[model samples]
Each structure stands twice: as C-alpha cells, then as structure tokens.
Target: MRYWLLILPKLPANAMAIFPFILLKKASQQKDVVLINHEKIHLQQQLELLILPFYVLYLLNYFINLVIYKNHYKAYFNISFEREAYSFEGDLNYLTKRKLYHWAKFFVKSSGDRLG
Candidate 1:
C-alpha cells in the first residue's frame, strides 16, 4: 500500500487520495494526519473496488449527487465514500476495526439521515 504524494498548487480540490497516489494542494498540508487518514480511507476504498471502478463510480456518483444537490460542495460532501471517510478519519485505528463493505452503510441512509 505504498503511495506517492504530489503537491500541486492548482489541484482542483484540497487533496485527492487516488489509488497509489495522493495529490495535495500544498506541501505543507502533508503533515496533517487527519488529512492523511482521510486519503488513506480512500485508498482502502479503491482497493476494495479493484482500482478502476472506484474512479468510474466516484465520478458517476459525484455527477449524480451534483445533479441531485445542485451544488458542487454539496455533491462532494454527500458522497457516501466521503461520508464514511469524513465520519471516521479522526479515528486513526478506524481501518483496523472497520468491517468489509462498511461504507455501504453510509449509502443506505434512513429518512432522518442527511449530510451536514
């Protein structure tokens, strides 16, 4: 699970955790463990999805959510994968304790469930 991190000031997002790599908007942000944890969660997810499909589904879901929410930020935040990562990135040991397909739960929200 070794990954290379590249810092690009013009990166579209704050950071991206693509499989085998992480792209950051600033080199200084590398020291943020919480951010790293968030990306690592994405790595785990990419592996679970066998790499390629993760990106495809990510884009598809983002577009769909974008249409549903009609806002870029809302679409990104409401993504189930983002939901799971943001919900647990602060817990460094989350991956060890996480169950297979645990992220699926975020996608199956109840009527009361909504992103903040």
Candidate 2:
C-alpha cells in the first residue's frame, strides 16, 4: 500500500497518540521521516478498514477504552492496530516492500475484524 504524509502548523502535545489527521509536529527531519512511516502504517490500516469505517471504529474503540481505563495514553497504546504501526514504523525499509496483510497479524480477533 502507498501512503501520504501531511504536515500541519499546530499540533497538540499528545498529537502522536491521537493525531486525528496526517499532521506531525515537533519533529526533526529524521524524526519526521519516522513519523511519516508511522502515519503511513495507519493509512494502510484505514484503507483496509475502508476509510470512514476505520475512523469510526477507531474512535469508538478508543473512547470505550478511555472510559474504562481512564487514561488516554494507555488506551491509545493498547490499541492493537496502533501497536502494529508503532512497532514497525521506525524500520527504515518498512515501506519499501511491506506486505498488504501484514497488519492483520496484530488484530485482536475477538475485538476486531479483518479486511482485504
């Protein structure tokens, strides 16, 4: 999958966790590259989930976890999809030849469904 990275003017302090868009802030050139890779992983995920549904599911899951866990950061970190993106984002060659279904391995079957 191909992904696009967008940069914005202002971002919240916790933007990395719940950015809600493609913008990344407070990053050096190298860090920006890594962050772009991270967001690219998310873009792949969004595509897998069919765009709008992905964001809907993402927000629902996150809010549910936030209500239960009472910690936004913890909730964000615990998201399996996010975990997969973060885990591999730093790999310089991740986007070069990544497989289409790689992210599916990270899904929690009971809580989430897979798409092709």
Candidate 3:
C-alpha cells in the first residue's frame, strides 16, 4: 500500500495512522524514525484488517479497555493495536519481519496482560 504523511499542528496525538495516511503533529516528527515506525506498524494493521473493520475494532477495543481501566490513557495504551505498535516501534526492522495478524497476538484480557 502507498503511504503519505501530512503535518497538522492541531493533531491531538504525536502521530496517527489512517490507512494510507500518517498524520503528524509537526513536520519535525517526520524525522523521528521510531515515531514513523510506530505509525507504519499501525498502517500494516489497518491494511491487514481492510481499513473500516480496523477502526471499528480499534474503537471497540478502546471502549472495552475504558470499561476495564476507567482511564482514557490506560485504555488507549492497552489497545491490541497500540500494544503491538508501541512494543515494536523501536525496532526499525520490525515491519519486514512482521507476520499477518501479528497484532492479534497482543490482544489482552486485562492490564495485567499488556505486552509491555
């Protein structure tokens, strides 16, 4: 899949991966390899799920995590997708070695089951 980057100063997060696009909070973030890799991991996850279902599952996971954690930050961090991305974001070669449905392995039942 083709990927594109856009700089949006008002983005709530440092970066976000929306299928073919990776939205960044600032232009300098484009040089942050770890940040870009994190978003790329999300892109692969979105592509694997065919986009729409990715968002649906992502939101559903967040809400379920919210109910379990009662904190937005905790909920967001515990998401299967986020877990996978954050865990491997520092590995520049992770994408080349990643397998299909790899994010599924990060799915957790509770905060105790978090990847890292």
Best by lDDT: 3
Winner on lDDT between 2 and 3 is 3
lDDT of 2 by residue, 1-116 (tens): 53334444476642343334565554453356676677777777777677787778777767866775678886776566676788898896886677775755655544334221
Q: How many residue pairs clash per model?
A: 0, 0, 0
Model 2 accuracy (lDDT, Cα) = 0.63
Which parts of model 3 have CA positions greater than 4 angstroms off? Answer: 108-111
Q: TM-score for every candidate vs. truth?
A: 0.91, 0.67, 0.93
The sequence of per-residue lDDT tens digits that candidate 3 reaches over residues 21-70 is: 99999999999999999999999999989899999999999998898888
Residue 105, model 3: Cα distance from true site in angstroms? 0.8
Q: After superposition, which runs of candidate 1 have C-alpha atoms over 4 Å from their true positions?
A: 110-112
- Local error of candidate 3 at residue 49 (angstroms): 0.5
**What's the C-alpha lDDT at position 86 in model 3?**
91
Best by TM-score: 3
Please state the error at residue 85 of candidate 1 in Å.
0.7
> All candidates' lDDT scores?
0.86, 0.63, 0.90
| Lowest-sum lDDT 10-residue window in model 1 | 107-116
